[model samples]
Target: MRVRGRLTWGRRARAGAALLACVVAPAVVLSPGVAVAGAAAAGAAVAGTPVCQVRDDRLREISGMVATDDGYVVINDGADDEALRRIFFLNQRCAVVRSVAYPSRPRDTEDLAIGRDGTVWVADIGDNDHSRPTIAIWRLAPGAAKPVLHRMTYPDGAHDAEALLLDADGRPLVITKGGSGTVFLYAPTTALRPGATTPMASVGQVTLPRTSTSNPFLFLGRGVVTGAASAPDGRRVVLRSYADAFEYDVPAGDVVTALTSGTARITPLPDEPQGESITYSRDGRSLLTVSESADQPPGTRPTILRYPVAAAADAAAHPTGSAGPVSAGPGAPTSVRPAAEEASGAGARPWALVAGAGTLLALLGLAGVLRSRHTARR
Candidate 1:
């Protein structure tokens, strides 16, 4: 079904919300097969080898990624002058097995999500300049020729959104790109209406650490919310930035509250060129990522990389309180910390020692005073 909506001014970005903003691999002209499955790299920010390169001409600029029973569904950044409406389905090794074209012409298609009901959802949710009056989400059932389009409007105004998440109840949730190191959450009042303009309510906000986050003036770092995916079972939520990724344990009712309340488990996804989309594997364990293809060779072809689920789970287990680098074994992800939880433990010992010394001195002074009083009485 075809649908359209007009833009209305909702909320404009605050005064200082824009920010400034990949390499490539050699092209192997072949069908999608032979993706490298090497062990995940060690160390922080390691530009690990890619799982595979998408060589499909039409699928080269792979902007969104989602996992299916047999393969993956992907799309490109709708940044070109012409509008794009086609989505590609790729096999296990990243080959195009099929393509689904729907009536909706998204102004900028940045990411996609799969609902619990087996429907494939495409997020026409990218507004780079914050100029769009409305954003759209199109739902297509498996094997359905046509898609039902859903329009989402921000209560405040148009926002530059890239990440999309469907919570446990199958409700569409959004995290706007962070303009001031804090990303805003938005969602519809209920399960949205098809082909109707629905109002999205703001839920919560998250602020990244100082050592974390970037200036919005740079183009790449604009929102820090490039792609998002939820676990098939709805137990976990994964949010991605252009540079890294974070996983949060979803609370019973609202996942947004879990994210903004400092209950995040983060891991780095280093060295993907213009990474735009993220998804969970069919088994719902590992994470799959998609990046826009770059012209440069020897590195940075539109890449698909997998991060082990255990790595993320291990990080979440070890909340960072102690100071020092979080090192990983040969295959596990290197570090997990909320500003070094273990480091805080280390600092505590020294303070305890100082406190003990102060107590001892106080006791000694009190004894001296008592002795002097006895001598004065004599």
Candidate 2:
């Protein structure tokens, strides 16, 4: 069902209340500390100013975003509809300037990166079920009409990833999303062939430091890397989770070394609902962020938030080191399967079931409200 224009008040309320119940109910049932911590974190962080609100309904599930001189470039998450699966370029006021269609429907495009030379790379590395034989990346060079596809396979096995980083040399690096704070890194072992699959070797791993940052997802959200970006100057890089953003200094343009053995400055992005998109501003002095509006009220549009680079640097005097190298062997485990993966199987959790039921009720309530309004008008 395609949603067009602004939603009515009843629809908005129904969506908001249902989603709130689904999230809040689980938090209360599980632990009160989670909610309390989230609240405290929200109060501690400096609030980001809203630059602009997304008006396009098709951009509801924005997963990856990158800042451009004109405005920004964004991509939606895995959508069943092929029409919604394209790269969108938004102007400074958050208006869709133009969009470039992918050569084919992407499996699950999760992250986006652009090189210094105006080469855009779209990472289609999301393997939630760990079943995809070969994940892929799409490259759109400067002035190219369409993106060229480059398929890649993991040397070990299939792993789910959402963060993609492009080094100063414009080489793409994929970071796995492991629930346990520790995540593995992978880089292309050989030159990428447009139509042929290339093997990705396990390079190293880094464990994100535990923080007191609060988010809707609570503790589980702290470890997952949702999005990534590099500084335009090539001096720094960042990886963000649902709750916070971690920035590392890239010494001499070696992004891999920075991720494997660097100290990270942590900035809390508190209480973001499914925050998944991040990028550095054109000047590299601030970080811009956007969240998916799925859990927000109906008709709610996602807004871009800007945080100063100094805020992150000043969060801690002596930031703890969170990077470390791991064995780059084929036997190395790339990721610890998240709870959602387990829930996808026979052992589904009770909280997940409750959330599903709440969603159904929300849909039914919206239908009833719409139907009653039509009858009243007649």
Candidate 3:
């Protein structure tokens, strides 16, 4: 009587990918010719090329991604009790260097950014239902014993956010995934004390060009902003979506001006499996993109793509302006946990507990899934 033995990683990612498919899939099935034509058109639109593919199963649900001198660090989007909240470190070859578990559970981290001082900031500010009065941001200086959690509340109201950026001084700045298409700004007004709730200052706004969201397929190229990454010097940044990525050259560290009045260099992305994460390479010469893999049977895993920035940087059509007000917690002293002591390999799997009724569901659900898998293998 197996309970949850058959609930594999690929199956879990497929569930996420299925959601994207449903949103973009057409109601009427396409004819064979139309399908081929659609694929061709899609191919033409994806100009960003992939440098390599990451094969790790743990990162199949990766959401927040940022590149560091050592490698790219990422985290899963799961916020539930049964879900994991760990940081996965990937090297240049897209191989796992390490996976660091959090000291405690994070509510709903959606994006990540690296500050000027080499500190990693994790955006725990996700309010899908706008039910939370306050959201949190986690700060980590790699090899730290624990994260410094900085909690903040929106001054206006609860607004869902997935993008976060730290200024040259390590201050946190958030952009709301608002309906107005005007990227709403939320800057911290005071030093982010670990336990104190700080007020999010609305100092400025960056109104992006409004795009239609009627057709699901087309919407991929024109949906709400999902992720953001700023250049190391705070001189540039990029905003990402499901199917497209826009680059802004922040002139004089001004992000608001770029978002509002500056022209952006748009780079269309290939159809990614629930793609949501984007970042800049350590050298600031290329853009790296990641997707949440729905690695179904005989399908693809999450891909790590590097879009050439040499041309894009030289061809900056319009420069972005900047200004700001924000706060960041004082750096908390940290001690690294020993590699042997930290979870690794199989031990790194999330902390999940199931009992009673959950056990029953696992048995039935696992049986059906196992049966289908066996049939597929045959």
Indicate which candidate wins on TM-score. Answer: 2
lDDT, candidate 2, 1-378, per-residue tens? 112343532245335555656554763355444344434545566656789988887788788999999999999877666667889999999999888998777887889999998888999987655767888899989888889999999999888898999877777899997765889999998889987999999999988866656566545567779899998998889889887788887878999888888777666676666788899999998889998655375556888988777433331443334433221111111222343442353323545667556656654654454333210100
lDDT of each: 0.59, 0.73, 0.61
* Predicted candidate 3, C-alpha RMSD: 15.9
Error of 3 at 316 (Å): 11
> Against the true structure, what is each candidate's TM-score?
0.68, 0.75, 0.69
Error of 3 at 220 (Å): 5.7
Q: Which scores better on lDDT, 1 or 2?
A: 2
Return the TM-score for candidate 3, rounded to 2 decimals.
0.69
Regions of model 1 farther than 4 Å from truth: 1-43, 79-84, 209-223, 298-300, 310-378
10 residues in a row with least lDDT, candidate 2: 326-335
Give me candidate 1's TM-score against the actual structure.
Answer: 0.68
- TM-score, cand. 2: 0.75
Model 1, span 162-227: residue lDDT tens: 788887677888878664457888999766788688888998887643222222112134236778
Task: Supply the global lDDT for candidate 3.
Answer: 0.61
Ranking by lDDT: 2, 3, 1
